[model samples]
Target: MVGMTEINVREFRDYAAGLAQQAASLILTKRAEITATDDIRSHSQTKTSAVDPVTEVDTAAEAFIVDSIHRDRPDDGIIGEEGADIPSKSGVSWVIDPIDGTVNFMYGLGEYAVSIGAMVDGQYVAGVVINVVKQTLYSAAVGHGATVTYRDGTSTILRCRQETDPQLSLIATGFGYTQTRRSGQAKILQEVLPQVRDIRRMGSAALDMCRVAEGTVDAYYEHGVKIWDVAAGIVIAREAGAQVRVPEVWEKNSARGTLVWAASAELAPAFERLLSSVGANGEID
Candidate 1:
């Protein structure tokens, strides 16, 4: 990991955003082809759990991203959800999630994204997430504000809502793939569901965090999200005025990380307290 001082924020931000946009384009093209095919699941397979699906498009997207990064930034390490891991030689690394909501993409739910985050010495410096179906782009760089570009080509600065009242907070969350972890997640959700305005199970964590950034959701919390799932969106959320908190000790390989995001600084503590009250701040045990 390289120190933060060594990174060129704007340059890397542009690069990451471009990579994400290109990857999103690739994903959308593949999605179209898959939708036209009769056997959509023919090239799909289960991973880790029978419910955890991986499609050919996911692998192809990751390959394109990894190859692009290797050619453009050979010294930078790459870690991707589709099994691309290269050691860093330049103190920089890119985290990639080819398709954040594969299930949603497969079922034509229009809730998936391609997420890319650049980090220096394990600290995020730039990030980008593109909603493939919606054609929306969310991006951020450290010390710079977050912004969202719409399908119409107009862009707007992003900001989280200022609502501090927990009951009025429209929280977004997600479930795990395995039955055991999902059962534990259910127990936690049961305690917190009635206390908020409502709960939305958005199929994509990356997009959910982006929703927090854009004030579409007041807060978001989820357990067992891999780093690739939230790395890019978390930066956008934080830069957009949302306060985000993750586990003190992060282990990318462990499917037990907990992430919490609140719309504003004042609401973060209140949200954290609510999460603790419901025992949602810890691992799904």
Candidate 2:
């Protein structure tokens, strides 16, 4: 990767946001076509586990994004969930999740999103996530604060709740695809549930991170999510004033068997202590 002294993070953020918006349109168009093509479901497959579905739309979207990035910035690398990987020549790389919640998308849920994050030398510089069905967008740059836009074109600066008490804080989380892994996740949830206000099993990790950013949820913690699943969301949540510590986007499989959490600064300490108490602060599966 080529090293450069200065990088335009905001511009990169905008480009990623634009890509997410375009991909959202593509996903919506595919959804519309799915209604007419009943056999398409048969063509879909799973990854990592039986329940981790991957439709043609996901691959197509990733190809579209990879091609777009190649055309616009040939020297930049790309790492996509659909197995799009290219080496970086410009010290910049993109991490992308074409469809963050395939199960939710197939089930007609509104929690799925297209997530993109740009990094320089393995550090996040900018990120964007667009909720396809809801037409909501979240974006952030390293120095620029995060923001969320709604379907109505209205936008708001994102910020997690200040001084959100650990006991009263509502937490969001997700389960793994494999039965064995999910069983392990359940054990963590069992220990964490009674400590927070409640738990929400959102279908999308990207959107769940944005929920934490916008204060819709006080915290989010999960394990076994790939870099594409949380790269964009991590930047958004951190820029929105949420405390976060997770693996680098370029770290291969670093998130697997490791706990990742984001909470308000006020709640992070106690929440982390709680996680340690429950044996969630380290590798569990």
**Candidate 1 per-residue lDDT over residues 120-231, each given as its tens digit:** 8788888899999888999898888899999899999999999988898999999888888889889888998889999998799899989999999899888888888888
How well does model 1 score by local distance difference test?
A: 0.86
- Deviation in Å, model 2, residue 283 alpha carbon: 1.8
Please estimate how well model 2 matches the true structure, expressed as its whole-model Cα lDDT.
Answer: 0.87
What clash count goes with each model? 1, 0
Model 2 Cα lDDT, one tens digit per residue, 1-285: 644233588888999989999999999898788868675567589877777789999999999999999999999999999999898989999999999999988877778999999988888878999999888999998878999989898999999987547789899999887776688889989988988899998799999999999999989998877889889998899999988878543366443567788998878888888888988876655
Top lDDT hit: 2
| Alpha-carbon shift of residue 244 in model 1 (angstroms) | 0.8
The whole-model lDDT of each prediction reads 0.86, 0.87
Off by over 4 Å in 1: 1-7, 257-262
For model 1, the run of ten residues with the poorest summed lDDT: 255-264
Candidate 2 C-alpha error for residue 282, in Å: 2.1
Query: Which window of ten consecutive residues has the lowest lDDT sum in model 2?
Result: 247-256
Best by TM-score: 1
